[model samples]
Target: MLNRRHIRVKVMQSLYANLGGESEDFSKDQKFLMQSIYSMYDLYILLISIFIEVRNKGIDQIGKQKQKHLATKEDKNPNTKFVNNEILKFMGDNELILEKIKQQETIDWDLDSEYIDIIFKAIVSSNAYKSYMKTRMSNFQQDKEFITTVFREVIAPNDKLYDYIEDKNLTWLDDLPTINTTILKLLQKLRPNPTKTYLLPELYRDEDDLKFATDLFTKTLLNQNELNEEIKHKTINWDSERLASIDLVLIQMAICELKHFPSIPVKVTINEYLEIAKEYSTPKSSNFINGILDKLVKEYEADGKLNKVGRGLL
Candidate 1:
């Protein structure tokens, strides 16, 4: 399911595509966004699949090496040690992940397979692995480092992968780093912090509900009669079709959040979209969206139509 971060990423992608010359074809951008959003889930599955692939590759490599010659005391082969000790153990311990990957057939074979291969190769070829080997030789340690290294070195470098990942995933990329520095900071944050609890069940459930709610909000906002050419003409000075199109779409999305997602505090919705506007629209887009949302929120509040739940939601 889509999360706030995922929504942000989708908005960013759509904005990029729009600004990159897909403005005349909103449907194309919409389809691309939708596909990107849906692909996030698939990306996770593909990652697990790739992990297994790497494990298998390691096993094969070890078998071949073992068939050729045994390790000597004078000449320590790091690659053989890596395969026999670290990789094989990881594969054995992570049977559940392996099972999940095996049970599923990739929906987008090209994207999934190619992405996995790229990530796997990147991990095996990274400086992190070399650094890790200098300090530690345990398979468990190597596996941990490998996962982190791939995310850091490989996955982060490829913007195209993010597009594929966004298409597969429903949520969780919105707040992620757009730059390498931010990503490193994030990776540091995701370190096995002791305070973190295993709340996968709750997280998954919330994600599902949010996805449904977001879809509903999008549909309702698009269907609103108030968001018409008349409203655009009155609210915005842009007479150009391209500018107007982007403005109208953003305004509609913001309005949808204001009306449909009551628990999402009005200010948060406004702020989120304002940030999005700055990245997606004209330089003055943040101000423009801010003004419109502010006006609309006041109007909705005055009409007693702001039916939000929970404390501090207003």
Candidate 2:
């Protein structure tokens, strides 16, 4: 569930916050950043729940309208058949999203009103809805068919619209890093030995390695700038004030692992950071990060600074 890009996004948010705020406290900033990274799942669930609420509201509106009036020939009320049966019912039965909602206690479903509205509008305007309407107009003779078509085409795609809304929604996530940290802390406390008892055996083997990577990453972000002159020198070339804090943290993490983690391959570190940069930074950030890391790796190798071990690591 937690990908490199997600992690980088979290880091970037934290960095941005720290830069904006006048506080010089790195510890506070670090805590804020990590927390945000951890809460991405919760944010996703919140967005989906909002979508569900909007879909339900739309269906309810249509149902109420149908109950109040008898359908005329031209009035072909497709809402009664499609809205209730196809759209609302499917949202109710979606176990994955429902389970996520059930697990979340802090998120208020009512708070998603604006987000829902945007998603609903986007769904109605989508190409999918037009296609459904056209198909229904051609093939189905009954009013019920028209309703079903609208429900299937317009309301069903609300889920997709929710995704679009989420991908574009950033202003609401101003405190995202802080929220993520709180959720992750809760999850960790709830299942401390998850890898030992719940994780698959294959996954357990690399648990330590993954932890090492994450820990190294965390440490580098938290301490490397203050401790390493080489890092400071490289950072001098970039606009530290304007740089996305998340990108800075992720780059530091990647560099730390590249030089310090002997068992991990250079390609893995570079690839991981590149993927992360794409998600958390500006569109051009991945290319920029990739170039810098590539140069750093070559410089490290030429200076006989890299001391990697293990079969696949180079």
Candidate 3:
């Protein structure tokens, strides 16, 4: 679920934290970086668990309606299609997911049942849910579509839910977009019957990615003096007022990749930081960082220091 860019963002975040005066210990900062990366997976688990919790609530609602003293015909025979959705059922029953959540030892719905209830109410009231249950069909594909639609439309954009999540863990606000996309992509690719036990997302793409986060964070921290010299020589009278903290962090990471990481192409490293700056930095940050990086890359090449290997590497 996490790509190289996401890992880059994690490194950038760790670098910012290190430079933020929050902690001065490099080893502690490295541990924080690893935990932060794992937190993304934890957030993903918490979110996908929402569908299962809401589905359970939906089933409880049907049961309660049936036991009512003055139950109407509609109440007595509530549509179970949404509650009995196969995809949701699978997710709810999947041992892999169950064990993962158990390991995390968190279920936000338990603490905030009202949030799940609110989301359920929104789902049933939605045109998508109404149309889904209007027809008495419940195939795997239809079930998948309805659950995905509810998540896409109701659960993800829900203000109360968002506030609840943000309050639970502040970093979740950053992890939200990635977690939402991960859930949707996993939902999209789910087959009716899978050969494996579950098509779960791996925390790290590979061991190398796991190492990349630590390496990037540590390298940038250790080489701060050298990187500062590089930026200082380029920018006259540069300080906190002139450069956004995030833009400065991004540039440092880019410089680290260029000088320390040999296999990475110069263009790829520059483009990655530029994109990150555009999103996480100021309006003019992309162009500003781009200009500084352009000058630095030229200098590195001229000094025979930016000796990048690989076919496409510059």
Candidate 4:
């Protein structure tokens, strides 16, 4: 699920796309932004399914090796540690995951078998895989740790998988960090259970979260003139032409939140955008944006325009 900062980043991207002339149609661009976010959740599911693919790859290799006419003893009795990893077994039997695969039809690794082959080969060669195979009678904690190491070492950094996923969906690159982190956390939280029902994260926490995304997108677009007027007055010393378009959009968003989002604290809004500016804008943008928004926030306060509600909301 996307937190407020992630949603803000999506809104910032949409605003930048429209303001940057990447796309002139605000409504269409906004729809693309929302879709981009939903696409991220799908990416998460697709990524989780990779573990199953990797396991299947392991199973397939063992079967072929066993059928070799002069197969070695190792081939005849291949280590089944990976195929039987508790976490993988649990996820394989997870009803929700199976249902979602049928429902979404978004995660098809069969067409891209080379990636599964590459990832499986990397795992088979790694010390983590070898060590797990040598361990005897592994518990759930051991199974969880091994898969996490395999994921962090092999799957997460595999160039082939990364390139393939990014090529398939451009939005995956932007979402990779958040989705990977969330999956890792979910993996960490798993414990042995007979119910076999693992909790998959939702796309949004609630309808309010959905509303927040569209509201920020819509309000920023609707109040662009007013927001820019506020920025223009505050940055009288700096030429708007000299400012980065990204910086302009971020500041405009911060202003929108300050005036329109009454429940959000002014300080929280300022800090959030400043942090976002660090990643998406220029190196000096955090402080540059900080100065303009600081002055405007003070001015907005003086004018009694910010009608914040709730305790400590103003």
Candidate 5:
């Protein structure tokens, strides 16, 4: 599911792309924003579906091994531990996940199944898988733990999988971290007998998050000149041309939230943008953004311009 910081990052990416004169149509940019965010869900399903595919691959390998004319006793009766993983089986047949997967347009692992083979090989050869397969006995807890361990160690970090995802959709590169973390946490907390709908979380936490993403993108873009002026005033000592484009966009977004969103605390907005800058911008970007935002917040506080509401909002 999407979080606010991730939403902010999506909006920042959209703004960054659109601000460079790539498109003038506001609706198009907004459409791109929503589509890009929704694409995260597609990526989620795609990545999560890797488990099912890898398990199937294991099953097929076992079948082929049995079909061989000179099959060894081990191949004839191969260890099916990974193939019978309860967590993977649950995900494979979950109605909600199947429905979502059916609806996905951007993710077709069928075409790029080499990635599945890659993940399957990595998982089977891993220490976790070897240790798990050493025993024919496994409880649901052990099964879940094995899946989580391989996911965290193998599938999630595979360079080939990462490259395939990036090549599939550039936006996915940004969404990858959050989606991978979400999948990891979901696996970590998966119950022995989970419901059909357990894995299918709503993309936005609530409608408020959706509205916040919409409003943040719209207000920042529409009020760009004003936001630029506010930032310009704070950066009188710094050269405008030398400022990172991402830092400027982040500052503008923070200022937009400060002035336009009364319910969001000033401190929260500042911290969120600063954190984003640390991840996405120059090495000194967070410090630069923090300094400018700190000065602006103090000025806004004195002039009664922040208008932050609720207790402890200031």
Candidate 6:
């Protein structure tokens, strides 16, 4: 589910962490980089597991209400619509999902049942829940729509759940938005009955993307001296030490893509880094990096140094 730009962000972050010097343990850093990328899947699993836990909480509550000595007819035969939700049951019973959650061993909602309780309470109080409970009979379309609304409005935005995720893994905070987006998209496309493997998405789109992450990280680190020299003359007015570390790293990565990865177009490289800068660096970073890159691309083109290939790659 991860796209190329997201992979670039991951590479950029690792590069930023080791910006001051060559890492003493390059393999460890590489391992950490891949681990961090894969951990996004774990976060995805953790988020989806909330649905399963909430369903379980509902079942438990219904059982308790049935045993009440002063039970009304409503309590004895409560609306089981939320607990019997088709999508939730599908996720809860899917062997592949359950196995993956257990294998990761990082996310256990049973131990963190309080979060489940918190989300269940939020869901019960939601208008979506009220409208959904009005119908007792299960319909896939209604169940799916109700789930989408609850997830988007209630479960995903709860402050306690957010804090719990933050406390569990710092890197997960960045992945939360992306993972939530992935979940919503999946929910939208889900069939009334899907295969067991439907929810398990591959991390990288293909092997090439996997290679791109490693190559970008390694090439940028190894070509530091050459990349620095390229930036040196362009930024003559600015002290090298005074340059924003993030801007420098972004420039180096962009340059690496331009010269080393000849298949990628020059415009693509420049635009990608500039967007990343707008989001990650100083407010002026996009313009600043753009100016230096514009100058370098001009010089490289004039000197026939740009090795970009394919039509319109320049």
Q: Count clashing residue pairs per candidate.
A: 16, 8, 0, 0, 0, 0
lDDT of 5 by residue, 1-314 (tens): 89999999999998988774322357988998999999998899998788878888988999999999999999898888778889988988787888888888866778888888888889878999889999877999999999989988998889998898888899899899899899989988998788888888789999999999989998888888778878888887766678889998999899999999999988889899989999999999999899898998899889988787799999
TM-score ranking, best first:
6, 5, 3, 4, 1, 2
Steric clash pairs (candidate 5): none
Across 22-78, the per-residue lDDT of candidate 3 in tens digits comes to 234677888888888888878888887788888899889889999999999999988
Off by over 4 Å in 1: 8-38, 69-81, 84-95, 107-121, 139-146, 158-208, 211-222, 233-244, 302-304
Evaluation by TM-score, superior candidate among 5 and 6 = 6
Candidate 1 per-residue lDDT, tens place, 1-314, comes to 23574465465455534442212334565676666555454445454344456556666655665566665643344355444444334444565555555665654444456665665566667786566546434544455555556667676666666776566543435423433344344334443322222111122336555464346434533444555443465475645455545665667666766776677788777887777677657888788777877777787899998889998888
In terms of TM-score, how similar is model 1 to the real structure?
Answer: 0.64
Best-first order by lDDT = 6, 5, 3, 4, 1, 2
Model 2 agreement with the true structure over 112-215: per-residue lDDT tens digits = 45656665675567665454444333322333343344434454345554454355455325434433444333333433122321211121134564465345
Report the alpha-carbon TM-score of model 3 versus the true structure: 0.94
Among these predictions, the greatest lDDT belongs to 6
Could you say which candidate leads in TM-score? 6
Candidate 4 colliding pairs, count: 0
Q: What's the residue-level lDDT of 133 in candidate 2?
A: 46
- In candidate 6, which residue ranges exceed 4 Å CA deviation? 22-25
How does model 3 fare in lDDT? 0.83
The segments of candidate 5 whose C-alpha lies over 4 angstroms from its true place after superposition are 20-25, 237-239
Candidate 4 lDDT, 242-310, residue by residue in tens: 989999999989988888889899989999999999998899999999999888877878999878888
By lDDT, the better pick of 1 and 6 is 6
